[model samples]
Target: MNFDAFLHSLTSSFTPVIDSSFNPEDYIHVDLSPSNALLNQVNLSSAEDIELFLENFLRQNQKKVAYGGYLEKRSIYDRSEHFSSGSSVQRRNIHLGMDVWCAANTSVLLPLDGKIHSVRNNKNFGDYGPTIIVEHQENEQTFYTLYGHLSLESLDRLNVGVKVVKGEKLGELGDATVNGNYAPHLHFQLIKDMHNHAGDYPGVCTKAELKFYSSNCPDPNTLLKIY
Candidate 1:
């Protein structure tokens, strides 16, 4: 089976990346893509503005968690030079992972049994603040999962090669001040190949790079089964 198929076979039901107490029904699919007309009213550059919009969104929907955005083209990146430093054609705004938006400090849980591969504090303006990557294997095949935008304290005692089980708490979500200045959320991605990367990988790609990146990073919902 191919990588996407392999991931689907690993889980039989909805998988929670945050607190398990939240059932699948608690998650509402959110649209951050440029196509979402509502985003046009908010100030995309300010973390506080985005947070307030997100709060209203969740409150109106009566949901505790907001998720989605695999392979989604977002304009929010336009606010940061980290993604908008290049020409228009070279701008990297297509997201390659699934974002779980919720309250800050929410527990982030492991979706699969794996070992800590690497961890780092990417302090760029629009980057993953505290990140963790875990390596997993099944039937001789190896893959990886990335958890980004975590609390600084999450990396305190973590060490490379430490074993972790599914559903185990890996860390808590970081706030705007530390998590790339965005609303609190977990950027969860399934990587088929690390490409020698550790604790860091492109979570977004430009249209020109989509062909290769879309292949390397599959839709995370394939494993989470949250949709």
Candidate 2:
């Protein structure tokens, strides 16, 4: 079976990646793409500005979690030079992971049983701060799950090859000061191939490279089933 089909077969119901106390109803789909006119009113460069926007968005929608953005073309990345390629067409703004926006320190859980593959502190600006990659094998097929923007303390106890079960507490979300200077959120992604990457992988890509990146990194929602 194909990767997408394999992911779908792993779960028949909604999978919680954060605070299990929250019901699936508590999550509201958020649009962070450039097409969202509402974003134009806020300063995308400021983490505080983005945080306030998310706070208001969740409050207004009566939801506790705001999630979406797999393969979404976002303009927020423009604020950081890390995503700039000096050419508009080559700018890396297409998000490759599903972002779960909520309060800082929120518990991030594993959606599937896996073992710790690698961990690192990717301290680059506009990058995933404390990241973890978990390796999984089923039906003789091996794959990986990546958790990014985690609290620094989360890595204090993690070790390679540590066994973690589905629904296990992987880590807590980090604040802006540590999590790539963005609003607090979990950047969750699935990878068919690690490409020798450890605790880090390109979570965004330029339009010209979308074809390959999109195929290597599938939509995370296929496993989360939050939509």
Candidate 3:
């Protein structure tokens, strides 16, 4: 099925990214684009700095959680070569996943029934630490869902080809030390074409390839239905 049909199917079946008790209203949509003033004030290079930013921002907004940052151009990637745009390839600044900011040990739930496709600990500054990609099938059309920035413990018993049900306990939100040194958050994404990549995928792409990447990775909100 196409992305539109896949999204429509969600109306009948889907799962929450967090606990069922969570309320959508409690989540504040955040902007990590270049135009955001807060980015200019805080040194995101330090995970602690991002943590501090999250704390103050959440308190001020009177919200318990902060989310968003899909397709956002982030300067935070400048910390490591993993997101390098200075080489032969074009500069990669646009983010491709939805980031959910919360407590360090908060649970990250599965959004659909699937089998464990791949798992890896992409240990690097500004990387996806302890990542997991689940392969799913809907109406005979297969797609994949990726969960990044997870606690190391989450992978202890995880293995490839293992079946996982919808809304299952996928993992917990990892701390900065194991979660690519960013603030505690979950980077959730949907991929129509993995391009043979396993255990890792480009969650961000250069502007030149935006057209293709955008179509490959549709807006996660289409399934999440949360702003």
* Cα RMSD for candidates in order: 0.8, 0.8, 1.8
TM-scores, each model vs. reference: 0.98, 0.98, 0.94
> Could you tell which candidate, 1 or 3, scores higher by TM-score?
1
* lDDT (Cα) of model 1: 0.94
The 10-residue segment of model 3 with minimum total lDDT is: 7-16
What alpha-carbon RMSD in Å does predicted model 2 have with respect to the real structure? Answer: 0.8
What is the lDDT, from 0 to 100, of the residue 216 in candidate 3?
92
Worst 10 residues of 2 by lDDT: 76-85
lDDT of each: 0.94, 0.94, 0.86
User: Which residues of candidate 3, in runs, are more than 4 Å off?
Assistant: 12-15, 87-89
- lDDT by residue (51-73, candidate 1, tens digit) is 99999999999999999899999
RMSD of 1: 0.8
Looking at model 3, residue 111 earns an lDDT score of: 79
Candidate 1: give the clashing pairs.
none
- Candidate 3: what lDDT? 0.86
lDDT of 2 at 32: 96
